[model samples]
Target: MPETFLEVGIAFAGIALASLVAAQLRFPSIPLLIVAGILLGPAVMSAVDELRLMQVFAGFGIVLILFFLGLEFSVGDLLSGARRKVLNGLLDFAINFSLGLAVGLLLLDLSPLGALFVAGIVYISSSGLIARLIFELQRAARVETGLILSILVFEDLVIAGYLAVLSSVSGGTEEAASFLQPALALGIVAATIGTARFISRGAQRLLERIVSDELFVVAIFAALVLVAGLAEMVHISSAIGALLLGLILAETGHVERIEQRLRPVHDIFAGVFFLHFGLTIRLENIQAVLAAAAVAAIISILGKTATGLLAGRIAGLSFPASLTAGLTLIPRGEFSIVLAALAVSAGLSPLIGSFTAVYILILAVAGSLLARESLRIAAWVESLRRPKGNTTSG
Candidate 1:
């Protein structure tokens, strides 16, 4: 038992070291954290064995990360953003999802269900990573930022539905049994939204009246866990529940306090989640799919770049700005893993999990580096396109 404590403590110390390196490099810590996990994981040096209880914390970490993400925007804001950006959002989905579907169906020749899962992996971007990158890269104030976030919001909403349908599909073996699960899932989403609208004021009142910090934290945490657990019971994603709860709470006007109280908990869990995820992966499986994973990653990157450029142009951004959108949209971390896990759980293919591990590792690093250099890349492209003597515009 003491040995377990020492091992877990050492793993955590490694997380701190990775975070420090990322901080010094002015890089996003996510990729480095995952790398630390990979290095310490059994597939590599086996410096650290899996800590089972920490895995539970990691699960909460993902929930809290998504929950906090929900707090950043409310239901009203999400609806409004979706309304305004619907067309571009649709364009973005059509272009990128089609690319993923094509790869899954044609390139990999996966089963239809497997193909859909792959398309989903290709479709969703990392809300946690990209949101941070925007501030990190100092592009938060740019015109393109709003468009990118709106697109993210759209994906967030869509993913709930996607997860609903996916959960339905993955859980059932019969063609006829599949239809009802999604309907139930959709109903749950609608009901959740309605309930939030009706009860937000009560929650706000309750929150305001609560004087004890312990009571306040416990209440919120309990609600998050209960909703997430119930969501899983109904065959929908717990993440959907976590995210929606956040959306509801965001409307209560205590966003800062909620974040402040919960951020430390979120960070610790998030680090553990990535580390536990790395521990679960077998490096040999990834090696077998190395060629396919490479092909998929290349296409996925190109597809996202094109989608961003097109979306940015439609919104009337300059080429550099459009390209910046493309570049910034590269990293795929949490959502991609979620989708792959679903695929594997559904008995689709072991390949999907292996493929995603390599895919995420490659893109998370590439995406961060690319996003960091977006301005320079866009500048170079603009310079090449303009007449040799023509001044840059927009």
Candidate 2:
């Protein structure tokens, strides 16, 4: 009891110290939080023992992160731009997912199931981390921001289906019941989205009656948790449910109020989420898979960057905007880890987990750094593309 409280207190202190350093260096605090976790994890100090409690906090962090992103835009926006979002999303997924599968199959010689897991890992970007980056960098108003959100929403939708399929695959059952699970999950998500889109106003009116801040916060939190739990019960990602709830709330005019109230809660839990991710990784396992992980990470970065560039262009962004957009999508976090853990739990390959941990660690840090310097990279690329004698008068 006392020991648990002490360990948690120390962990929080470590996170606070890491955050302080990150602020001084003008770096994203997420990667630093992860590093702090690594230093204090079982592989190192083994100072924390309440792993389950940490996971719960981390889970809430992810939910809040996605939920907040969903609050940024209304259902009408998604519906109006559905075509563009869908096309860009398909293109992004086709390129990156294929590259990951190919690398797993040809380069690493993984089994079909293992390769599919790799595809899952590479297909999704870290919405939680990217959302934080966008806020930290103050890029929310940029032209490319909408396109990025659209693509991320699409990815979240796809994950719902992907997890369904993965569950069936993992169970080693070709039975009809196994196939039905994915369908059932997708159906539930579709229904939820539809309800949110059509009946959002009614929901909002009901919510508006609660003028008390304390009660409002409790109600919103409970609703989110309930929806997320329901989604998980259907074998869909709980984050998707939280995101959809945010989207629903976005339809109302209360987004700002909700966001302001939720920001503090989001920060604390989100920090735990990143820290827990680092704690799960075994340093020694990473050493054995370093080369392969490096290869995968490089391919993932390039593939994602290309996808982002193309998607941004499709969304009518300029070269620099597109480049920055691409760079922003390079980090792979929560979903990738979930897929990798799924693979390991299914008894596919232990290497998948280690490789994923190292791969995510590298990209999360590098992606944030690259996004910070995107303008410089964009300028460098633009210079190379300019004609030799194209210097213009100012």
Candidate 3:
């Protein structure tokens, strides 16, 4: 017991130091924290084990992260203007996902399932990282932000379907059984959303009666955990459940209060989640996959930027704003990691996991720097494109 406490304390101390350094350097803390975890994890110090309490914290951290994301926007917002935005979202997905599939199938010669997993890794940008960048950069109200978020929302819904398919593919042996899992998972997701939409108002009123902060927190946490667990049982990711719960709660009009209270908890746990992810990566195996990972990352960066630019243009953003949107969506984080882990666990290929780790690390760092400097970068590109006589005086 004492040893566990000591290990936990040490881990937190290390994370704190990493966070401080990240702040001092004006870098995204997530990648640094993950690097710190890699340094301290089994590949190096092996200071923390898989069975520790940190695992529990890491799980809840992801749940809280998705939950808070849901609070930022409501279902009505998703429905409103969705028709105009759908094309952009679809284009983004089609381009990026196809690029990933090409890399996996043509370059790596992976099976269809393996290529699908690769597509998932490359297709979706890191919502958590991008959201953090939006807050840190203070660009949430920018013209292109809405389009970027709409794309993310669209991706989230797609992921629900993708996970259902992945689960079915991974678990099924017979042809009919394979189809059943995805169908069941999709049905459950649809049912859950339908039910939430139907009962959201009543749920809000009931929640309003709970006046105490302690009870409110407990109630919300319990409900999130329960829903997340249920989702997992149905073969969908628990994060989706938390996201849906947040979406439902957003309709209640108490999102600001809930967000305010959950912010600190979300921060600590989400950090742990990233750190935990880094801990799982085996650095020794990275060298063998470095070339492939680099190629994939380059393709991912270009494809995502193009996708974002197209999406932004479709939404009526200026070229510079569209470029910023593209840069903002460049980082790949949690979902990529989740998909890679699933692939590895299902014995698709160990190399896939190592490749994913390298790919994510590179893009996460590059994306952060790019996003931070997006305005300047965009302006510089625009200046190069204009004729010498068209250059404007400041």
The candidate maximizing TM-score is 1
Residue 347, model 2: Cα distance from true site in angstroms: 5.6
lDDT of 1 at 210: 77
RMSD of 1: 2.7
TM-score per candidate, chains pooled? 0.91, 0.84, 0.89
Give lDDT tens digits, candidate 1, residues 1-394.
8878877987898788988998898776766776787788787878777557766777797688778867877767766745567887798799888988987887677899899998988888888789889987778899889878878878877776787788787897677768888888888778767677666788798899878878878888899999899888877777777887887888897788888888887888778777666666677877877888788878888988897899998889988888899888888888777777667767887778777778787888888888989899999887799788777569
lDDT per model vs. reference: 0.80, 0.81, 0.80
Q: Clashing pairs in model 2?
A: none
Instruction: State the weakest 10-residue window (summed lDDT) of model 2.
Output: 164-173
Backbone-clash count (model 3): 0
lDDT at 364 for candidate 2?
Answer: 81
Please give the lDDT score at residue 230 for candidate 2: 86
Tens digit of per-residue lDDT, candidate 3, span 1-394: 8878877777787789889998898766777877888887888888876535776887787788777866765766767887866887799888999999998897677899999999998898888779889998999889889888878878876865686679667867788878787788778667756666566898789888999988887888899999989877766667767877887888886787787777787888888877876677687767778888889888988997898788877777899999999988999877787677668767887777778878888998889888999999999999898988875669
Alpha-carbon runs more than 4 Å astray in model 3: 50-53, 172-175, 387-394
